[model samples]
Target: MTWLPLLAAGPALAATTSRPWGVLCVGLLAAVLGAVLGIRDGVPGHELAIVLSALVAVTLASGLASALRVRRERVLAAVRSVAEAAQHALLKPVPATVGPFQVAVRYSAADAEARIGGDLYALVPTPYGVRLIVGDVRGKGLPAVGTAALVLGVFREAAYDEPDLLDVVGRIERSLARNLGPDDFVTAVVAGYPGAGRMEVVNCGHAPPLMVRDSHVMAVAPTHPTPPLGLRALTGETPSLQTLPFTDGDQLLLYTDGVTEARNHEREFYPLAERVARHMSDEPSRTLAALHDELLAYVGGRLHDDAALLLLRKPAAVGSAPAAESRASVGEPTRPSLLQ
Candidate 1:
């Protein structure tokens, strides 16, 4: 470990700050004086014994401090390991490709202290088609994380069982209704590709998704206004479904409010659509990388809220796998092996 030497030196360095060096210097000086006196008077002196005892005590204290530092480092390392496991459990990574589209995800939690936060995104090739969801919970921290987990849990199961895009959303709505608090809700955009150059999007009071077509970018906002999930009881309203043409070479970008709301030093919100227009390309991953960097630069380094970006682009040709059978081509879910 690179930190080993630093950790070992911590106690000794701290002891120096506590004036141990001065004590050692004084003791040595006293011993020297005592030796001279003893030589002149032909008598043994207490100063020499006191200096030896002081040296022994300092050695013992230094050892004790080093042991404590090592223990603290071990505890911190274990805590970091557990945090990493939690992050992996919450934010499972998406493959480079899913169904008939190339996929890439870029996520950052505002709370840099923790790996996982409130924002959530997932893309799964289900029996119905390639289904995806990007949402932001009402609050931050652990409670928001729990809500996000609940939404994804329902989406993953419903995406496989329900063929209809609306039905998949309904499952998540019902789950949130039963689980969330009165004041809590989630703003989300759930999307799916059933086939034939058509993409269905259901917006639930979230930011509109941006679509890139032939070097042009536009927001895919729903025609009808809808309340966010979990607040359906309050509004008695349901999310509206939007079906749009997604031809080959076209790209779709789904993101949370964090992207739009991110501000630079001058307190200006990041212009997402304009930036996407500038960065749209054949590779979804590369486009997202550029956007992510610009976003960090815009925010002056750290984002103040959880941000998630999910990009999907249809290839020019379906290749060996037909669009109808794209679900079968999806690889198994990749789960990180936590330290056992």
Candidate 2:
């Protein structure tokens, strides 16, 4: 959480303005100052010429050094700014608190900042319920980022105004159909956590989200899933929503392919499900900490894509669990009242 933004801006700031490019500017300034000093001190001899020469040499060297650093810094800063904008667009700044869940997300791009990869998640409180989307766009750089923004924009609007999950998905499909390249498509899972304690999920060929219960981790997968969002037109019936039994104190983990697809030094994939199942914690924050740490350790701090993680805690339910059969017999139509 603490590891974001470069703290070493001292060099960048000094190198940018009025010859801020570190060494060059410094050297030039030093030379000018030296000449002024020589004049004031009245040394108009061979010694003065030698001092001027040294000052000129030093100034040129310093200027070059500073310019190189400034160039590097500007590129990094540009990248950071882009990543920040993408994050804002993807996350949409939901209220810090919603329902019994306190959600927090972290995204780290494979490149220092300027690198273009978009791993996205968006949560919007809608008339139908609280709708959210989490997924990774294919490719890297601006193309991927553009796709991410496109998907998020469609989902945000559709979630609020559309009642059916399929309809919301349809909106995104139409939007992408007009823009996405023939080979480009995003993989994702769009979900509606309609308040109370139930979740409606539509899997669009994305990684299965993890559900944490009493410290146990299980993947929340749909029984039937469609292809990723943009390719929906290629497929027939949309994926059906699978209702989940969410309770207070339960946590839902949504992530991008970056986390699961990470490769280790041995070239083996990061074992996200296995690791999460083994390390899940009762506390949402703690669970995330453990997962994030293990992820970083697995890849040795190198990631290949924009990795994102969103943790949601439903808060603890007041009453006892309904009979196991109760969930089997119940349907989503009857669940909205549970929010009360």
Q: What is the lDDT of residue 300 in candidate 2?
A: 92
| Candidate with maximal lDDT | 1
Worst 10 residues of 1 by lDDT: 331-340
Q: How much is 113 displaced in model 1, in angstroms?
A: 3.2
Candidate 2 lDDT for residue 208: 78
What lDDT does each candidate get?
A: 0.78, 0.70
Error of 2 at 4 (Å): 44
Per-residue lDDT over 225-255 for candidate 2, one digit per residue giving the tens place of the 0 to 100 score = 6688777667665667788877666677899
Off by over 4 Å in 2: 1-55, 64-79, 94-96, 317-340
Residue by residue across 1-340, what tens digits does model 1's lDDT show? 1221222233345544434454444444444554555456644446445544544555457656555666777798897788789777777889999988899999988977687888998888987789999999999878998998899889889999998898988999899989988999999999999987788999999887877766766677678878999888888887778888776777888999888889899988888877887788889899999999999999999999889999999897835443442222111221211100
State every prediction's TM-score relative to the real structure: 0.78, 0.75
Give residue 77's error in model 1 in angstroms. 2.3
